[model samples]
Target: MSKSPIHPVSSLDRQSELENSPAQLISLDRVSFGYSHKRLVLQDLDLEIKQGEFLTLLGPSGCGKSTILNLIAGFYKPLLGRVTHGGEDIKGPSARRGVVFQSNALFDWMTVEQNVGFGFRFQAVSKHERKKRVETIIALVGLRGNERKYPYQLSGGMRQRVAVARSMVVQPEILLMDEPFAAVDVQTREGLQEELLKLHEQVSGAILFVTHSIEEAVFLSDRIVILDRNLGGIAHDIKIHLPEPRYTAMNRVSDAFNQYRTDLYLKMKAIE
Candidate 1:
């Protein structure tokens, strides 16, 4: 049997090709992270996410994908490497980097609008401005009438939307999501995916989404990053040059989609 010609792109070459392009938004350069100087969760990683790009980090548990997210979110300090946002070193969390945690981090005591508007309560925004912000995000996340509703009043998916809305109300420069849809049911998850795509299209902010599901990664990302546990570094970084607004072919189940998913699955398994 003869082997088909593999794509002639090297990982580093692919990375350089992306970096040398005009749209690259964020870059992780020689990033090494650990609790101590020796104990490393992530070892010398370099990744570049383009502007308005939806990039998903896919790997198994303990593969340090979440650790990378934490580093990007400024929740954890990297012992050796630095995180840069648009060419500046990220010293700490900024409103520019919006964060969405796994659990619905909504304010139980606050209504949907209040929760979304809460960021402005301390800021200089006036009462009318706050209401406008809340209203804008409420509509964006499809939670219009639910503004008066509390966290308990909404479904799990709705709660997550509130979380998203709260994060988006401030209109950060980038969005960092850590398995945001993992807790929802399949149907709800699908809907949330669609909602996220719409939001991404409208907002056009760079997104770094972390998920274990290859399908979700394939469905949502402009590119996918797979980290291997052994080195706590990237195993595979694949560019998905599929056409814009992916949800239209969400269920296309094409040779390209399946091939991408299978390759991601295999890389994850190999890491294990």
Candidate 2:
């Protein structure tokens, strides 16, 4: 697989290629994990996240959606099998895999500029390059003027943007988001979802997002995997076929979108 840069393209053009992509950036092979050995949260899970594809995990609570994210993030190890990245074992957290939590996790003491650029401090990048990258990502996330403001001064959406910018500034190969937009208002969450799709287009990295909203999963995902309760593993792995330019409001009301929503909603309700 070539590690070439992804040029900016329309969502319509990108969708076909993303679906056809053969590169597997992350793989979970026969993975089984439990916080306690008495009951496994995820069992015998085999999954693959392709490079540059946006894959969302959807399920009811305690279905191990976040547990799978944590395993890929290397926050926890699978007790029975292994999680691999680029064909190697993922022993621990690496800068190659970025994470965004439900909370923004920004430093209230640090300005937006400082927080976004913080990752560079441990890296070997020069001061000039660090500033350049930070400014570019901040602008990409639509936070150009609020560089000096602290997280306390920003709205929930804006602070989440900063968290996204912070994770994205380092250019991780795959971003693991554990319901990063779940805390915001409905209107703000919709806006953030649009912006996130735009960012994914520009950045061209794989995104593994965990969300409960079937609409959100349908809107943002190229594919969605639903986990079953009681460690039943993946119940349904569906390919989303919504019309391109998926960020628009029209796609939300389209027949294809609603059908997918209805199907997924029924599947989820059945799980509960």
Candidate 3:
């Protein structure tokens, strides 16, 4: 990975590099959406996600954080815009985009292994092969021994981990997550954030993570996009620009951390 450029303009140059340097993976152009013609949630929004970049959409509750994820996932067609993957328009859902909802969405009756294997069920793969992939993801998510357990048998964090494994078992080109860590306790949330940072480092894919926590966004995302309701589009596309090998707690009191956090805090307060 290249060192983060010192000046803010360097971040904009990074966007130019991704757009013109033949590495762009996903692009959203003039994307606008409204469910019932009442009001536009996203208005004239455009974003480019380069390959292997981690981007976070942070906003207050009901401010279209998840709506952006849905638009990318092809869950809803934009009222007046385009969603493209690899330069081609994304018209509907595809296995290439693995989505992990805020809810665990685990089947209560199925074993964890069975739930993870569900990703490949529609592909007509052999049962043995499906079991093998599920087993690998089970280990990947740190749930190897708990494979036979049901969702009810696991802790909230464990269940969320399993949900992650299920989404990633398909080896998607992009992982679209909607506040996956919201329901956990603060301690568990922090630990899970660390776990995600490690997993993201090891794995290479474009990740669009939605969260309300600026701290989490600072630690996890390559770039943080703040959605503003009044602006009706992305109000801020802030780069984290931190040193490599970032950890959750080491820079909690750093000036850079406080600066970034305070800016986002003010933005949130303005929204309220």
Best by TM-score: 2
lDDT of 2 by residue, 1-272 (tens): 32235454554556667667778899999999997888889899999999988899998899999999999999999999989999999999999999998998998999999999988988999999999999998998889999999999999999999999999889899999999999999999998998897788677589999998999999999899999998888999998876656678998899989999999999999999
lDDT of 1 by residue, 1-272 (tens): 01111234433553454456686567788888878877777888898777666789988787788888888888887777678888888888888889998897888999988888877866787888788768876898889888899999999999999998888777677899999999999989988988887776566477899997888898887788888776667888788755444665544477778888788788778878
State every prediction's TM-score relative to the real structure.
0.87, 0.94, 0.86
Q: Which residue pairs overlap in candidate 1's backbone?
A: none
Candidate 3 — which residues are off by over 4 angstroms?
Answer: 1-21, 123-132
> Between prediction 2 and prediction 3, which has the larger lDDT?
2
Q: Would you list the rank order by TM-score, best first?
A: 2, 1, 3
Give Cα-based local distance difference scores for all models. 0.79, 0.89, 0.79
Error of 3 at 113 (Å): 1.0
Off by over 4 Å in 1: 1-23, 122-129, 249-252
Backbone clashes for every candidate come to: 0, 0, 0
* Candidate 1, backbone clash total: 0
Top of the candidates by lDDT: 2
Model 3, 1-272: lDDT tens digits are 22132233443454454445566667889987877677767778888887767899987777788887998898999888788998899988998888988888888999998888887988878888888878876886688899889999999999999888888777677899999999999988887777676566555567899998888888787789888775467778887765545554765667878888998889777767
